[model samples]
Target: MVIEYSGIVVRSVLTDKREKFYDSKGIGCYMFRIDEAEVVDATMHGSAARFINHSCEPNCYSRVIHVEGHKRIVIFALRRILRGEELTYDYKFPIEEPAAKLPCNCGARRCRRFLN
Candidate 1:
């Protein structure tokens, strides 16, 4: 494990409201969804893991693991990453309508062109 994506866990229904609140204040939202009803709000208390960008072909991957009785998000190396290599992972966003798709510039040979 490289680092934990630390943050407060919140109900998924609150994501939209919180994101909008952040947007109104020009605060960038940084969150990792855990499931249909849970998400980690990292905009205010995240680690460097939250700053890692997306890649079509990534060297790291994010996972949710249970420890004791708590859930945590962890970033793990996907392979033998060379020194100084940037850490990244596929966002794996849910598919959306074309008009709402986010453009991807990951530049991988097999790039999907869109993130969703």
Candidate 2:
């Protein structure tokens, strides 16, 4: 028997290409840190996964999968998402200073005003 799943689809990557635009604007954020000098920036070649917005109270979350010395970001649903609902997840980036906070428009009831 063949089974089919229909909700949100995720993709994977295995490269490190810097985004000068984000770096220049200082608005870009790292998806995951692989090492002291390297980070996984989904915007480099992201798919639908990149488009997923951030929510303080996200319905989805990401998990890192290490395989053959490479790190991949996998997103999983935290609950049964209904059709037409926007897929969102927390960026989970650390915030050390007020100057580092970015603006957020997620529209979540618990929106923190800034994306940390």
| Model 1 lDDT tens row, 14-94 | 999999999999999999998888999999987888899999999999899999988888999999988899899998999
How does residue 1 of candidate 2 score in lDDT?
9
lDDT of 2: 0.62
Residue 21, candidate 2: C-alpha displacement in angstroms = 4.6
Once all C-alphas are superposed, what RMSD does model 1 give against the true structure?
Answer: 0.9
Off by over 4 Å in 2: 1-17, 21-32, 35-37
TM-score of each: 0.95, 0.66
Residue runs of model 1 more than 4 Å from their true location after superposition: none
- lDDT by residue for model 2 (1-116), tens: 01111222123233222345566777553345544544555544444566777898898887766659765567788988889988888886668598777888888888888887
Model 1 vs. true fold: TM:
0.95
Q: Pick the candidate with the highest TM-score.
A: 1
lDDT of 1 at 9: 93
